[model samples]
Target: MIVITALLIVVVLTLAIYLFYHHQCRLREMAFLMGEAVRNGDFTFRMPRKRMFFGERALLKTLNDMENNIGRLTAQNEVESWEKLTRVLTHEINNATTPILSICQSYLASPSIKSSPYREGIEAIHDTTSSLNIFVDSYRKMTQIQKPDPVELNLLDFVSGVACMYPSVQWHIDISSAQTLFIDTNLLRQAFINIVKNAIEAGARNIGVRWNRQLCISNDGAPIAPENARNIFVPFFTTKSHGSGIGLPLSRQVLMMQGYDLSLAQMPQIGFHVTFIVSSTCGSC
Candidate 1:
């Protein structure tokens, strides 16, 4: 009886040791998975809520803090980039406008400016002035982007209003489903308007806008040349001669403020496409 009791005690001690090590192994695995998610630029991953050992809990908290810091840094970088671009664009625009305005004034002051050649020159000046005004307008819009007061809105209705505003542009919208989303209606309208305007300037005759419940996965899958794609959301990067380059960046900023994201896809057969992903919790807001 004494021998049996001693063997039982030994077995219990071995089992307890095994269980403790196993628990530690699980915690290490969880930590590794969380680290991988962070490395992949996914700051939204959440740790499991189950109670963990004190050390494990501390490690999880550290990771969460790291993610938040990274997010804040990334946002600051974007804002700084915008400020730099705005300064450069403003300087260029002022230089161009000053020369054009001076020339127009000189032409207008001349008493003998009634000839056909002079009239053509005046028209040229007018055209340059118009272009300068547009450039200044774009710069103003970028510098003054404001936060939107969000409200629940029908996606279809909102899109319809925008399409109506631009009768000359052909919009092919494929949103047949009735989805209501909470968004800053005015800001969203401005964003879509900018996107459609860019497409038009890109020589696109037909613009297609589609929405799906699975937009998150679709957003990640869009194909773009990695080089051009990285800076698509950066301010003041444009392919157009007169583009202020703030439209897409501002659009992204608006969406991001509301816990959303935007991505670009290049369809070689169909040109470039942009996708917006609204988070689940922020869906109604």
Candidate 2:
């Protein structure tokens, strides 16, 4: 009987040891993945917290929260840096190009130079300078965006108003929870308009908006091609022939300045070909 009891005790001890090691192995694997995401500078990657031991769950959650904070701060910093750079570059570019444009125009106004070969060269210079000036001016205007003045607004009301602007398109609005968010009316309206315009340009006949822990806008439009997805939010990187390439970037900038986030979700999100997500980092603001 003593030997039998000793054998049972040994078996229980071995089982406990195996279970402890198994849990530790899973924790190491998850920690390795989280470290990889940080090293790659991809803070958007998230780790699962479910089905984990108490200690493991706490650690995973803490890591996820850190990632979220890092991503938000990084976005805000990028927007501020871009705005300062735009201000300086636009000022210098306009200063340098304006005089050349004027000189070329003044010379072209003379009839004697019309038949000269140098006339064509001067004209080309004028044309190029003019284009540069226009581009610089457009970017300069973006830097003048007003500081946001947030006010509490009904999400459904605001979004419905946007849909009303385009009666031709089929709209699906679902913010049945009727949540109120604090945001700048005009700026957010402009951002939403930009998004809707892009959807229309992409040949979308149906658009859907819903609230599921965040605001999601989906469209049955042409999906973003894989190759172009990486640069879709990059300033001045448009795939369209006449695209200014600043719509998404500007939208992100405005939202970022106001402590909000704007991102494009992976394909087929919530049964739509294209999805845009808007989430808040500022609570009660």
Top candidate by TM-score: 2
C-alpha lDDT score of every prediction, in listed order:
0.64, 0.82
List of clashing residue pairs for candidate 2: none
- Tens digit per residue, CA lDDT, model 1, 167-186: 76566666755777777888
Candidate 1 regions exceeding 4 Å error are 1-69, 80-92, 112-130, 154-181, 192-222, 239-244, 256-275, 280-285
Relative to the unseen true structure, what is the C-alpha lDDT of residue 8 in candidate 1, on a scale of 0 to 100?
A: 98
- Model 2 / residue 274 / CA error / Å: 3.0
What's model 2's lDDT at 67?
Answer: 78
TM-scores of all models? 0.53, 0.83
lDDT of 2 by residue, 251-279 (tens): 98888767688877754466578988888
Clashing pairs in 1: 182-285
TM-score of 2: 0.83
Worst 10 contiguous positions by lDDT, candidate 1: 214-223
